[model samples]
Target: MNELISPKYQMKLAADVEKAVWDEFGSYKNVRNYIEKWYEHDEQNYNWENFRVVIRDDKNIDLNATIHSMPGEILLKVAIDLGVDTPDFIPSIPTFKNEIKSEYKTAYDTFTKAYKQIESDPSTAIGLANSALESIIKEILKDKRLKSKIKGNETLYQLSSAILKEFNFSSTEHPKEIKTIGNSLLTANQAIEKLRSEKTNFHGKTNEDFLIEDALYAHFIVNSVATVGLFLNKFYKTKYPKSEPEIEEDDILPF
Candidate 1:
């Protein structure tokens, strides 16, 4: 179950558009308009960037397709694959303004929610982040491309670095650190599944695939949410300190 809604990919897409604009005409007035229009169009066809091309051991298999989503009509189509009801799903083509609005608000809402939650419970934040990261890594490791190359947790971090780089983060601090702080969530999930298979009342006797899928989805979601929260927290705390100990007006240039 590939979770399709990716804010990280969306951010990279916007950045790429900005760079392309800069390279073409220097700059544009707030890419919001362009972004809105792009969303209005389908995004399924959007080509993924920042992906590695891996060579299979067989040497005959070709896995050259981009792993990311696209802009315009393409992305909208991808949303359908999620089993989400859209214009294509309905004959009347129900207005999706609400859906669009919700989509737009998701990241900001997640950031705010995570921040407030973190402020009240720092331990919770760290725990949730670790749990989520572990889950995502488990799913990733299961992929044939990754499974073949990765022998242990160390190589998994290397893969995480490659993926996280697309989101503009370095693997040195949080990436590798997160990987080391805990083992793969897959192991834990598998253990739980095995216990459940034994019909252990303590394990709740739940569906294994559903449990793993839920964990994997939550893993990606929580990390992205926590990451945005942390970034915003640092930005505000550093830039707008409650106590002004230093002053340098020139440090910030006037827009």
Candidate 2:
């Protein structure tokens, strides 16, 4: 389990672990034994002897280094046991059931897959994040009016551009700040599209091609998908509110 996490992320995770330990157990008193117990019962049967050395000094464990070197799954487990939130780098997907009348199942499923593999399979995660955004855009265009405008084979950026135009997000009639935000979102979508084709495992890579192995890249792409997906869903609802059915009094039974 040679997992190489970003040094900055490792520091944050280490700090959270330290805070959780102090809050729950009141200092590093016998904290090493507590951690050892978890490893002992772990189904994978991790190498406890090596982990023991990492946290040898109960009061002075080099937690940042230990976290950086530990496997991602093990680190998540430790965080769960200590009752801390997952690291901020791991983006969470929102349940969009209430946000929209139609469900974007492909978007949700793909984003979930990306979130789950961010640490162990960064390249695949990046690809999945790109797919997730594409799915969201397709769902938005499912309306008959919007569907007529697209050829159904547009790229991610093209789909995003169509949606933005439909929402009047890119219209010059709006304030400069709003237009700027919309332009930035379009640019970000383009970047994700390029990253997927060139750096991810989505497309077969040649020996000369460079691949993204860092979790940081995957995290950024996945977070972007979540942000863009949420924004699109909210904006779609605002622009095209689902109309409620009219109930006739004559059709209702008297109480």
Candidate 3:
């Protein structure tokens, strides 16, 4: 005697799967629509950057889920065949405006918010600078496929250097300050690093308080990093795509 009923078990499985699919689709309708649009337009053609806008700004969906909802399960199946369960899921696109990515709005928006506090509480400005640094770091790591390496308990200071190492941008290749940037970055990391621990959000704690100059410098360092990082990220991705990292090393870059 099998412990299963024909009509009941079949109905239960079908209903559960249908509900699961419905829930998944409902939660990510914008994503579904974008994916559908891609299919409707040109099944063979797609741009990761434009597609990223949809993911970063609207869907907020992870890469795998987005792949699964791809034009027709083609890319998704290829990924599965490649044994990739968790691929490099890029975060909010850097749109430079409202026409740009929305997730990044928080980081950029902080600059203005911090400016307001510069006169009264410069420490808050430093805090916002720290936040921007954090945002760009996460963005860079996500883009470079190194975010997972930075654990939850890790500090931004830790990631600052680690990101550089992971990016493989040597002193000579560094866009700015070849020799001095490393030590300077180390010191900046140390100083701003404390911002994460010390309670400097409000007006208090003389020892932890930051001055206007410090806040301004903090913004400078972070903004510089973001600018340079975005440049390097885009450059490296084009030069050393995952499919063939050695292609540039063997063919180009030597010149």
Candidate 4:
């Protein structure tokens, strides 16, 4: 069964199965009884033998191991019965906005909207993804007191370069590999901006204009945003760690 399903899907299914078993049934014995009842009434024809061997042991069942070893199809059925939706195994963008110290709700919301509309409206998704990245960069710059360096109408590439320079990411002092990665990130940001303007419906495209219609392109852009956003955030934090507030001796009460 593990050999049949991809590792990503297997992890997602295992997590869903564990959640359903614990949240809905509360215990393995209860879920086993529920499945047995279904079998008794001919409600489901799922092969009980495989499930029984993993779930019906007398000792405390190794739930994690059991879930991982269960057949993928059977686990999916259990997930459905327990009211858990089948997991969509896709690349997940990290919540890079949370790492910012200042207001970032808009950027966070925009990124979420971009992720949700990736399949339904790829053009809008790409546009929103680009906007989210720009918003994040601006927020970071503002937080670091570097927003004044912007010339009011800078492109995504320019903004990224400014922030990267602030973090010394574009410095010649770094290793060759780091320099290559930084250059690549700058290029990716530029590409995303280009895609949003020329390949999307963001600027009111004409009928003759080419628009991105495939979700794969949206996925690529979103992931690119994720990569660049995360790199910027981590590098910024490393370069400028937040200072810990000093406790006042006068304010401290005697224990």
**Candidate 1 C-alpha error for residue 229, in Å:** 13
Model 4 over residues 1-255: C-alpha lDDT tens digits? 235457788688789778777777777677555555433222365533554334445665556776676666566455544545432533336344444325567777887777767766889989998888888788778764554466557788888888877776667789988888878888889989999889999898888999999866776787778767877877766777778999999989998
Worst 10-residue lDDT window for candidate 3 reads 85-94
Model 3 residue 42 distance off true place after TM-score fit, in angstroms: 70
lDDT of 3 by residue, 29-99 (tens): 65445344434344456633323313555535443444433332233222222222211211121222222
TM-score of each: 0.20, 0.67, 0.40, 0.64
lDDT of 3 at 80: 21
Q: For each of the candidates, give the backbone clash count.
A: 15, 0, 1, 0
Q: What is the C-alpha RMSD of each candidate to the true structure, in Å?
A: 20.7, 8.3, 21.0, 8.4
Best by TM-score: 2
Error of model 2, residue 231, in angstroms: 0.9
Off by over 4 Å in 3: 1-103, 170-179, 195-199, 202-255
Error (Å) of candidate 3 at residue 3 is 88
The lDDT of each candidate is 0.35, 0.70, 0.47, 0.70
Off by over 4 Å in 1: 1-117, 147-159, 162-255
Weakest 10 consecutive residues of candidate 1 by summed lDDT: 91-100
lDDT of 2 by residue, 197-239 (tens): 9988789999899999987777677777777777888888788
